[model samples]
Target chain A: MELSGIAAYLVSFFTFVGIYAILALGLNMQWGFTGQFNIGVAGFFAVGAYTSAILTVPESPWHVGGFGHPFLVGIAGAMVASALLGLLIGWITARLRTDYLAIATIGIAETLRLIIANESWLTNGVRGMSGIDRPFAGVFQTLGLTSAMGTLIVVTTFLVAVYFLVERARQSPWGRVLRAIRENEPAAEAAGKDIGRFRLQAFVAGSAIMGLGGALYAHYFGFLSPEAFMPLYGTFLVWVMLIAGGSGNNKGALLGAVVIWSIWSGSEFFMSAALPDAWSGQSGPLRVILIGVLLQVILISRPQGLLPERAPKTVPFGKVANRKERA
Target chain B: MDLLIDLIQLSIYGIVLGSILTLGAIGVSMIFGILRFAHFAHGDLMTIGAYVGLSFLVFTGAPVWWALPAGMVGAALTALLVDQAVYKHIRRTQPVILLISSFGMALVLRSVVQLVWGPNVYSYTGGIQRPWWFGDIAIVPNHVWILLAAVLIVAALHLFLTRTRMGKAMRAMSDNMDLALVTGIPAERVILITWILGGMLAAGAGVLLGMDSRLTPTMGWNILLPVFAAAILGGIGRPYGAIAGGMIIGLAMEISTLYLEPSYKPAVAFVIMVAVLIVRPQGIFKGTL
Candidate 1:
């Protein structure tokens, strides 16, 4: 590959990784901290993508648009839309078990996809929505920087900002309460913590982050499609990344995103190069199988994940002394 | 009279579709009743069964009826293998982790099916069968067969649960696992029975559904939401409830298309599911979670 070609490829690759990291981080908040099983991450992502696409894209024959609105307006709209959806679903299934939420969320995700695919007036159906602008595309081009490189810079900076915010929340008193509720719901409830309320908060916040990631992805790609947000590629892949990277830790989520995306994209390159023409058609399914097997192996061997959550170092000495005395 | 005929025709369509959904719902509800966690791969297991039926029809040159049974057997074995290889070990972990494992298993099952059958849609037979008229309404022979098969299976399941010792033991296990174990019900035996029955019924549902329409790689997975809605609407552990729930879901979905777009049919099932969950979390039949 040529120098610029490699740089562009790397930029595109990192941009995707950065986008997925945001998704994984959001999932970590829901599943890891709140013990809320949200298997429908793609639904929130799509909501963000479509909301922004509609907001920023030019007017078309089918659906209403924001008439080429500013990029910030699109991003904010995406987050709000996704967050509202999250809150609605969260409130409805809040009292149910984690498994119920999982099933409901999956149903929600599938329904969202169906609506997006079928509702031509809103989503333009199968033809998809295109021609959205990247942030500062004109300025970056004038400065002789490639659009890919510029997008990567934007995405990374956005990712860093999100990471810092989530990390701060993870260390806060509210974060402690989330862990408390996750570890022992009864105890948290007994301590006067409104478990459902806190859970809904986590769910909403996480979904908003995912929505932001979707907005970034739509702007960076300069296109949006229902096909781009299929659960197989969108939701399940994020789960695999979160699980492999260690669910509870923020850094693990980022590392998992990078590592898993590398293996995922790398295998495609390897398979294309290694397989003969006849065998190349099966490459997509083969990659899926590999990830599936990897998930199984990881679950069986390292259920704590590669980077398990660290224990909080704030236990009272008096409680330890009391236990020691009783023993 | 014309409207009545249309309504009846829609009901027939609903019943045929419901039979398939009922079979799947029964399998899923049975597993949840006994195993105490959702098997996320259950839909893909159905997919595996449908694909197996297609293979038997294509490779072995078997008749559709015989191929359906062969598919059931194949799916039953696959379910047993999944139990032994994955679920059994994961049972030691939390139920949530077990649920995640099932998701992984779904991925594996789907990919394997895609690898073996490829992604294109296939059918059991080449030519479409003409519908048999029932007075003013019409139904396909496959629909009749599907309804018959569902009735027979549900009757057999009832007899097994009510009359047979193993069936009663399975019921006892579902009612109270600790008490059942203390009363000398072999947990392994009950678990084994659950997987076998669940697998058989799921396979039957898959093949029947395939026979009705065309078989796609995503046939089972796509139908999952409806099956789940059925299972939940019927009450989680009640087989009879699943039957009723399936019919309700099927009828609602089809009938709603009369007023709404055909594309929004699946959404009808979802809306019903959410409403049921909100109003009566225990389900219409009042089965425990």
Candidate 2:
């Protein structure tokens, strides 16, 4: 490939990686930190994308997109919308087991997808929203770099900020409480922790981040559709990222995001190159199977993940001393 | 009288749908009750079964009823293989991890189906047969076959569980694994039997439902929530509860169309499932949590 071609690929790859990184981070916070299994990641992501798209896009006759606001404002609106949805779902389903949450979230996500598809007045039904504004299109054109590269840089920088923010939260006392509840819910309850409240907080916060990822995605692509936020795209893809990278570790989440996404997007290229024309249609299923097998292998072999959650370095002095005595 | 006829027609349709749900739900509930975790791949297993039946119809030119048993066998073998290859190894992990693993299995199964079936919608037979009139209500042959198959399977399962030695042993293990083990009930044998029964029933449901509607790779996945709802609504681990839950969900979904858009039929089932989960997590029939 030529240098320009290479740059294009890299930029597109990094942009997708950044988008998924944010999403995986959100999920890591929920399932990793708080032990909340949110199977409805797609729902929050869709809410974020559509909310922003509807808020910022110019008015259309068929749909509700008259706000025509600034890009950042739309992004904020997406986050708020997703956060509110998360809060409602979390509050309603907080007391149940992870199994219950899994079903509820899937139901919510699928229902949302249906609504977006059927409720044409709001979402334009199947056609989806277009002409979503990117944040720095003018700057990219001025620099003579492809617009994709500009979005890539912006999205990557945003991803780094999100990573740092999540990392900071992980080290906080609230984070410790979340870990405590995850390790042992009964014990956490006994220690006077309001388990439900903490779970709700994590769920909402995680959902907000996922929504932000959706906004970035919509702005970058300049289009929004319910089909883009299918469970396969939104939920399973992120789950694979977290599980492979090592849940509960922000850096691992990032690494997994880049590696797995490359494999996923890269597989199609490899398959098309390797296979004959007649067999090319089988490539999608082949790649899906590859990922599924990878997931099973990961779960069976390294349930803790590639980079397992790090053991805390600083221990309670008393406990350390007692352990030394025993040794 | 005209309204009554419409109501009767709807009820028949509901029952037909309910029987399919019940068969699928029974498999799911049994897996949870016996094996102690939700089987996410159950829906796809149903799809696999339906596809296997379709294959029989295509290649052998077998009658639709003849395809049912062959499909059930294929699905059963797939379940056994899947259990040996996947679920057996991860049996010791956290239930949540097992759940995730099942999701992977679902992916694998779905992709395999897509690969083999090429993602096209196919019918068992191309032509639509006219429905027979019962007084003023119309009943299709496919619906009758579905209802008949479901009743036969359920009755057979009931007799097997109540009368057969191995079935009773399976029940003992489900009731209390530790005590059953102490009493020398072979755990492996029971587990095998559970998978076979679950597989057979799921396949039966799949084929019959496929007969009623066009078969697609996602037919089972589409109805996944309703099946799960039926299982949970009836009581997750109770076979009879699944049957009752299926009937209720099928009726509710159909009846909901009176007040809701037909497109939102599945949503009605979901709403019912969530409501039941909130009001009674153990299920309406007091299932074990």
> Judged by DockQ cut-offs, is candidate 1 incorrect, acceptable, medium or high?
medium
Candidate 1 residues A1-327, lDDT tens each? 699788878888999999999999999999988889999999999999999989888888877785788888999999999999999899889999887899888888989998998888998888888888888788789988877788888899989999999988998889999999999999999999999999999999999999998999999998778888888887988999999999888988998999999999999999999989988999998999989888888888887788888855676889979999999
Per-prediction DockQ: 0.75, 0.71
Candidate 2 docks at the CAPRI level of: medium
TM-score of 2: 0.95
Q: Report how far residue B127 has shifted in candidate 2, in Å.
A: 0.5
After superposing candidate 1, which stretches have Cα over 4 Å from the reference? A315-327
All candidates: CA RMSD in angstroms?
3.5, 3.4
Query: In order, what fnat does every candidate score?
Result: 0.67, 0.67
Q: Which candidate is the best by lDDT?
A: 1
> TM per model?
0.96, 0.95
Question: What Cα-based lDDT does every candidate model obtain?
Answer: 0.89, 0.88
